[model samples]
Target: MLQLFKKYSVVIRFIAVFLGSYFLLSVLYNAYLIYSENQTEFYPDFFTNIVSRQSAAIMEFLGYSIKLEPHETESAVKVFVEGTFLVRVVEGCNSISVIILFVSFILSFFAKKRATFFYILAGIVFIYTINLIRIALLTIGIYEYPQYSAVMHDIVFPLIIYGTVIILWIFWVRVYSNLEKNESQV
Candidate 1:
């Protein structure tokens, strides 16, 4: 038993740290979400609004007349293009949860302190920016090619986001996390 424990100690430590940090961060985030839902000054909503407004602005910049309005009852920002209603920018579409998950995964890898902090920040920005472009491009795709809306929304767009996270994870593990380095040393 003692020999087995010594042999697998690294694995055990990694699992414990990863699970513990993920759980702690997730719980805190969920609590914040709950609190935000009840308050007038909700931060998540702020991010949602930024996403909505930015997406709409991007569309308009690219010669499409777009309008973004707050939904009265749905707690979402409604998007309209050239008097034609498009999609609703919901909480899920805001990308906070995605960013949270990304951060959690990066934390699980357990990199150097400064590297981890900067990488997390950069990853958040990358994900958020990509999400904005994804929403905008998705809306444009629906407007231009309504026939492919279902395919794009249901499949391709999601793939882009998830694929980006996977790439980011690969980069982290191969570079900053140095898990490979530690493993190779063993």
Candidate 2:
């Protein structure tokens, strides 16, 4: 049993660090959600409103007449393009949780302090921008095509986010995190 534990020790440590950081961050995120929910201003989804407004501004920049307004209960924002309601920007669409997950995975990598900090900051900005663009594109796609909305939202756009995270992880493991010398090595 001792020998088996020794053999798989690296794997065990990896799992513990990954899961521990993920859970801790997730708990903090939930606490933030609780606090946000208690607020009267856009209760429960402040970030979602921010994203929605940003997305609407982006669409307007591209010559699309877009209006983003709060929902009746104010739990979300309704995206209107060319005076037609198209999408609802909800809490899940805000990308905060995705950023948290990205940070968790990056934390597990544990590279140089300066490098890690900058990487996380840059990565979060990248993800948030991409999510805003994604929402704008999705709204336009749904408005124009309408039929392929499900495929675009559920499969294609999700792949973009998840795949970007996977790419970031690979880069970290192969390059950034590789600075951490293996204990089994000299």
Highest TM-score, which number?
Answer: 2
Off by over 4 Å in 1: 38-44, 177-186
TM-score of each: 0.86, 0.89
* Model 1, span 104-183: residue lDDT tens: 77877766788889999999999988998999999999999999999999999999888988999899978853656775
Error of 2 at 177 (Å): 5.2
Taking every candidate in turn, the Cα RMSD to the unseen true structure, in Å, is 2.8, 2.3
lDDT of 2 by residue, 1-186 (tens): 999989998777778888898899889888888888767676346787788889999889988999877777757788889999888888899998899888888887777788889989999998899888888888888988999999999999999888887888888788753566653264
Scanning candidate 1 in windows of ten residues, the lowest lDDT window is 35-44
Worst 10-residue stretch by lDDT in candidate 2?
177-186
Off by over 4 Å in 2: 181-186
Instruction: Please give the lDDT score at residue 44 for candidate 1.
Output: 39
State the displacement of the C-alpha of residue 74, model 2, in Å, after optimal TM-score superposition.
Answer: 6.7
